[model samples]
Target: MTSAQISPRTTAEPTSLTTRSLAPDLARGAMLLLIALANIPWYLWGAEQRDLSQHPVDGSTLDRAVQTVMLIAVDARSYPMFAALFGYGIWQLYSRQAAAGTPHREARALLRRRHWWMVAFGGVHALLLWAGDIVGAYGLVGLVLVALFIDRADRTLRTWAIVLTSVLLAAGVLALISAALLAAAGADLGASGQVGVDTGVAEPSYLASVLDRVVTWAVGAPAQAFLTGTIPTAVLVGILAARHRLLEEPERHLPLLRRTAVVGIAVGWLGGAVTAAQHLDLWGIPAALDWGFLFLQTSTGLLGGLGYVALFGLLAARLRRRERGPGRVAWALQAVGKRSLTSYLAQSVLMAPLLAAWGFGLGAELSSATAALVAVGVWLLTVGLACWLESAGRRGPAERALRRLAYRR
Candidate 1:
């Protein structure tokens, strides 16, 4: 089929980072803050009693509060939002190419080339910085989607999304129930323990870190990120949503947006809050609450992600009517979102030195609240930098390079 027949005749270029949709960009900027908040302090847990992947059980009330807030609003909540946006961006790239008159085969080739490079960037990010690298997983998922579903019909996308969502929820519920039963029967199988100890996410030698990152990328990219179905299902929703320009034209779909935002946020918040409270055992410290685990993750991933997207879409519509609502901060956040990839990597670059043992090792000393504050500071620094870049009419370093490689221009 010819390029013209393949895509809507939208005048705006999806790849034009300089002037993309404010809603998506704004959401991306906000999501990065949450990502930094959720991930930065994750490495700060003490190695003595608490697990590497969990908050220190012995935190003060303030630290506990910080931990609880992150669990309810940040943690697994950010990833699916990111995944959905990634999917939307993928469609944007493909449609942009088609609109620009590239043949179908050529556009697909370009996407493949771009994604493989993303995988390399992800690998480099993992090896040099954090072991919890997600870019590799995203790149892997993007490639598979391109191969399997990019050209599918809307009905097909919806069907697959629903099927995957069902499967994921079923698996999580089964796993949660099994773990609860095990815990009741006096098995410590689900006890939170040191996870990233061997990984570079914990204190490790350079060589050990490299090995650990490689192993983590190998396992997490192929297995945990995509196979769990959260990412894939979110991606499918993004694709179908893109076809209708749901986020782009939110006013046209206010009813859908409002209902989704309400239902999604409520469900997500309830599940996440319960999970946090159970873990904290605010009443009293008891045995592990295995039942809360799966519900927290799955609900936030599916429901929280949708809520975030819809909420931002509604906000964006209202802001447009107001003509730059909360002007300076909104503009700054949009700028940061425009350079999201660079901003995302910048979080690790700034925080690793302060937080990881491989560097200055502040993570060993900082309280949870302090770490979260530092993360916010780091995100702000990037926002300021992004605004400066925006004024200069320059793409962020990573975005510039990625575009060049993707388009060979």
Candidate 2:
């Protein structure tokens, strides 16, 4: 093969761990930490009232304080960042496949195989370890979008991204407005929908926790697919960003990045704060009725998430100009990012036994701040392990298996 033909293929294949960017990997690594923090609450089932929510309504002052902080910045913020990264990563997959001169039909078939496996993995993860599994939804929506838009033009990609995102956001804005009208009319909306386990278990039992997970997973899977449009919209944005060379070449798009960071973050923080206030009873709203707040985040989170992407891109540009490559921290994060699938699953493995009622039974005992500290410890464990694996020149077990499945023999 000519050098020209070989060069692109050599760099495009991410499965080989070549041609990776620091910022994307860093973003993924940071994203995992945040996801850990967000997801830990799902495991908390106490020996008390056995009620589950994002946080205990009757938590100590510190727990309430932690809940407010999380609601404003960390809770809804992390999902979109993770979703955007997932979308961006898939684009890398498709592009590399094309660059390798694989035929359209074959490439698509391979994509299908990878995602279906992902679906299987996600299904297992949700049922066994955690019910808030997003991997399955990403894979499901990914399969649909890849088939629909892989061959579409940049113009069409942008249009669809805008439209889908707009639809999701509009729904949120409408809901918020309606809720305001209801409040004005003194209508009692009442507590609706399950925020957490909500199993009504008075004391923790292994069997009860298992039952909770099964029921929640069964319910969450369908809600994840249809409720928010979070997956497909993020995927579309990733496609558009990839086509425009947004994250890959950030310095050239300074104005765009600046605008996105400022506007998206401002809107996101505002909406999130409103939700947090209401949830904390600062706004005198029932904490159980978080659907309104969920809508607020759902509407604005895409912007916040994309803004984070842009902000990270700008940071990457600075890092590139300053040094030859990343430092020790970046290297550690990249290691986890590179093996994101495995690192993510490892958290569940580590935490399920530590936090679950079926294991250490720490869930009922710890407060919000303490639980978050535990979450950080869990993430740090993975980061340390990822660094060791990187030093040993090893791929994550899940990543290796996934490549074998996706690439076939």
Candidate 3:
């Protein structure tokens, strides 16, 4: 098996900063914003209250509206973007190390260093503040993927693409068949089943509980990120995108991207709608709703994730053509992308003071609307701060630290 080696490149370019890739930076930044917005409502609720079987947001009309919009448009979309970008970053890292003529063993060491850096950062992020640690998950899954895919990149990517496509198709077909059978028997989806919370009353201080839960998730999230959500889908698709040079030189594949985007939009919307309808509380638990949720995730993951990638890729290509001048928003987003880890951690750190029950105790009080509004403000503040840092510094603190670690002393 070929070990994953870092890509080598001339350091003269130093920043590799360019306006061409601005769209992805902007889109990624926007995705983070949406993720934060969507999560605030969840944050307000204690983890103990997050039972999927029960309606988490079932109070006011506004709550339902937010839940509907997030599930339909945002939930499955944001993390995939984050995961795809992570894969892209990996490819770039490997490419640069390879170019530098770093020996294969040394290069592989560098990749491991980078992964470790992410793990360390993730630990801090989870323990100090936020519980939702993507980097922890990314580091773990990335180690596995890098080991499995490095030697035969082409083969690995192809196998993943085929496997994911098969899984998605199988799930979708099974869902439709189940729905038809239920309809024949005159089933309903809106019915309820017995569900309850069983929190063993340890009842620690709010901060202590948050920290404990975050620690547990930080340790285990990598496997779940790969096996459970859209991370696998994103990783497979990211490999495809990188191999095709979709991010670096997408102009070469603009036509294919455009066509895929079109198809993706149609299929994603239609399949998602059908999947959503299956959850009308008709047949109860372990029936239409449960099975339908699984298929819905697959279909939406395939269609919406790919659609967003293509759309953004096309936009990036267009921006490249229009002139290489950096727009303010684009520049700010690029800063966030450049030091993504710092910005990501910064959000979680900022969240602690805002969400901890020991603080405002808003951890379980705010309405969805209030949470969203506050999240947007935080995102704006982050963007502005990132832009300012980029103007004065070469890279975000986290980015510089990781690079130094990867290169080693």
Name the lDDT value of residue 302 in candidate 1. Answer: 79
Candidate scoring better on lDDT of 2 and 3: 2
Which sections of candidate 2 miss by over 4 Å? 1-14, 47-53, 190-212, 286-289
Write down the TM-score for model 3: 0.82
For model 1, give the 10-residue run with minimal summed lDDT.
4-13
Model 1 pairs in collision: none
Name the best candidate (by lDDT).
Answer: 1
lDDT of each: 0.76, 0.74, 0.63
State the displacement of the C-alpha of residue 368, model 1, in Å, after optimal TM-score superposition.
1.2
Alpha-carbon RMSD, each predicted model: 3.9, 4.4, 4.6
TM per candidate comes to: 0.90, 0.90, 0.82
Per residue, candidate 3 scores C-alpha lDDT tens digits across 1-409 of 3333223332212235443366557667666786676556545545323223222524476765665565556655667667777777666666666676655555556667678778777776766665566787777767777777754667778777678766776777776677567667777666433333211112236556665656566545764466554676677667667766787777898888898788776666665555444433433333434554655555565667677777877877777786756466666767776667777777766665677664556656666666667778777777777888878865667777877766653
Q: Give the per-residue lDDT of model 2 (tens digit) for 1-409.
A: 6533433334334465656767778888888998898877665665232112376566778887887777666776777887777778777777877887766666667778788898888878866767677777777877888899888898898898788878878888887777666666777766555444543222357567666666776677656755687667777888777766777887888899889888877877787788777766676544344565678776687777777777788777777787567677878888999889999999989988777766777887787889889999999999998888899988889989887776664
Counted clashes in each candidate structure:
0, 0, 21
Least accurate 10 contiguous residues by lDDT in model 2: 44-53
